[model samples]
Target: MSSSFPFPIKPVPFMYLGDNDRNLPDLSDDEFCDLVAVLKALARSSYPRLEAVPLALNAYNCNQGTDDDGERPWAYFYPITMIPPARLDEKNDLLPNYPEIELDFEVCQDLKRRWRSIRYGGDDNNNNQSMEFSPPARYRFLCFIHKHRIDRKNTLQKGVHTISIWDREWDELIWHDTYHVDRISRRKDIREFWRHVKAPGFIDEVDSREHFMSRIRYRTVYHICEQIEETLRGPVPPRHTIYAVMSTALFHMNNARDLQVSIVPDRLELFGGQHKGLLPRFFAHLLCLCLDVRPGWSRARQKRFVLQFRILERLQWMRLRTREYLELHDSDRDGEYRVDAKKKDGGGRQWMYEALNIP
Candidate 1:
């Protein structure tokens, strides 16, 4: 690690040089030392290419498994790893993740702040929630990648800038993680500030923090939705588990349930409802529910998914007045509301006779 770096100390890189690269045969002791010599020279100075950090992080650390090795997202020195395996590039929804990186972000201060700034984070806690964040809309992005080994799958490509994995090994890096990161950065202030020009804080200061952070949170949801649409290379994204994404986004932020809703738009376009605008931010609520998605959300996402099958299903479960409203309606005829227009052969229109007989 060099002392003359731009930011902090070079994060420690977890060392595990073994048979990570399959195509290239295992390095001979001499070759290994040569490679190490080259890397040690590079690490002796500053390499602040922030643009390429995440890719490196993804390749070296991000993945789901034991955190013993710093290979987790937080502890990578050099970014390039062996090329990802071939089964990774299957789809955009499944962002190949290095669980270590993902977990690392969860705890790092700066990275945590950055991640918290995303729409997914705004729905995590009620204490940190505000009156300005918009309820996230429901979306459906595919999850086509999930590998047995995510670490080795992050590297092994030619280009250092864009995703540069081999054609055959493209499927090895889960596209979902990459897609989301790319999509979110598109809405950032320094990089993609223009995308948020019409968002909550685009105008005057709504509240104290001038609503700056809140608006950032608001734009995140939009970014997520739009990105899925674009990155999935589609006219529309696939049907995700509905509330699953919404809840996940909110879980990241630590926001309140109802308070965040105050800021969230109430609907989303699921499949054919893109133009109708009847899509309620049930997706937003899903986020509120996902903070503890383990067992708590056991039924929530499923319930939201089922509601789309029938409108009445939702109104009944979430609304208290549905049963009362239903009881007042006429069941004998095809009509679905309170009985008042029934006119018999005897002439006059009739109301519920039970109420009249109340005397």
Candidate 2:
């Protein structure tokens, strides 16, 4: 648990996984060096693993070909450490008798606090059963809490704790989240691969980079945890909380101005569990599957009613976000999604938008 101040640093490999030998927008040698330095920072910070710790970043249209085209977006990664749950006595600071757990803080503060409180009888309020239990079953308890939490529904808010980088980019900050699980990769498992795009096989050096970016996608952290649970013996977990953000964000971020960006108040919420209520379920339902990429999509409509809860009229976040969205269009849906199904399914739906805490 003890680490030196400033976390005295070490450089890591940043194998550039793209094609740079072809026609790019053109960059002066000086600009290239600065850009490479920025990229180096990205590599150093954002290392990916084939396991739960893999950091998959969307480095697309990142440099705008070269320098001659326009202002280039910069790259950097956020390194994270995941902590294991707190210990049995709760007060006994062994923290599950493991070495320091390293994961995104923002995404999972609940584990220990919930554990500590349950073990110590702190929270007077009642939700799940009182936390009294033995220490040896920490992982089982973890599985229990995760399973029960998701089966319960919109009761728990905030989100899984995460350490993320909010780098400023062209009137907005484009970013990614990393959950470094501190495990090594076998690399051979395509299914184990995270934040990485795999092609049928290798390509010409020039085209390899393009093919790689095209394959970038997201997976639920639970998917990662599920894999972990499977690695253990005895009972496999019933289900893990992938949380809406993971599945929805590819479970990653993309721009709609071409699929992404922001936040605000006036009492608002957005996506997944936003004020949309039934709409959130609607999205959750779609996202829960839609992954098969099979012809069975035609059967999709048969289950349409699965998500058909009546809309909660004028949901708070819906109204607030809608207003903010109009303000961005200077007021308009851009008639984008209306004409094209793919566009509508993707970028067009986010027709209007803005960041709250908007400047």
Candidate 3:
């Protein structure tokens, strides 16, 4: 289905006060409270039907200790619930579909010295209290965009047009590039870098390297075409999947002597980072492409299509094996009198010529 939400999702800004040396903005308690209030008001204005606007604050310690003292809640925001509009006559108002916003607070004791140095001689609270307010190491704000399945049949669309939050001074907050979740290309690059660095010995063993290279020769081309087809149709595949397919395609294309595909490391580097089940997903995409099938196709249709191609490919390989066996037997008997037919047919025996035509 086509996306109901607009392409290129905009980034939402979150205040950060991590590095004192860099002169980052300090989000004071009053300022933070003002920001939260503004965000809540904005959400209500845009989506009036919201029943309860829940916001969560999580704290992370850079230097984690074994003690549970670090896990205590450093700060809290009052719970805000909106009154549900009462229905009049027979008409009912539509409910708000806004996603919950979560703010993460990275608390580092190491940065406290730097923070104190930046705000030297600041007023300190001497009130009688058992606990003291720990200085914030860093602040990150996160807002989620709910994945909505747009139905062309429905006349009314749900969700906000712009994903944004305003600061107290009425200035529109802007997100840094680091906070952009929709940066698929950037994410891919990070993934690839981690993968290569972590798996330096992935192709070290001779037998494994040979096996991987041999399988990729037939599998890579088919996978690339499959990915292209998916991309052409609506609902683009996941970034990770696309990266894996493209990476395999490039690797095989570079190694394959007959194929005219070229290498672009800049592009391939996107698929190389830390991710769950990355290796399996990589191999799975390769296998699916090799079989010329996709996830959404009917099981029966996929079986028929893939099995037919597999049978044909195996038969062709078997034919080459039989021809080789016959030639070997003939050579054994001829004893230096055999014709140069095997040498002449070497060009025609190339497996890619037949395999490439399957998909």
TM-score winner: 2
lDDT of each: 0.25, 0.25, 0.25
Candidate 1 lDDT by residue in tens digits, 144-220: 11111222233332221112110111111111122223333322211222112232221221233333333322222
Per-residue alpha-carbon lDDT of candidate 2 for residues 1-359, written as tens digits (9 for 90 to 100)? 01222331111112233233211223334433333332222222221121222222211222122234222222223233232332335453333222232333322322222222222333322233444331111100110001011122332332232222221111122222221221111111111222222212121211455443344332222233334345673322222122222223322222212112322111212222244332232222222212111224333342342223122334444334333322332112233211122343435433212111111
Steric overlap count per candidate: 48, 28, 5
TM-score of each: 0.18, 0.22, 0.19
Model 3, span 79-173: residue lDDT tens: 32111222224442333322232232221121121121111232322222322443321212111111211222222442211111111111112
Which of 1 and 2 is ahead in TM-score? 2
Q: After superposition, how far is residue 232 of candidate 2 from its true place, in Å?
A: 30
Better of 2 and 3 by TM-score: 2
Candidate 1, residue 65: the lDDT equals 24
Once fitted onto the true fold, the runs of candidate 1 whose alpha carbons sit more than 4 angstroms away are 1-181, 189-191, 194-202, 205-215, 218-359
lDDT value, candidate 2, whole model? 0.25
TM-score of 2: 0.22
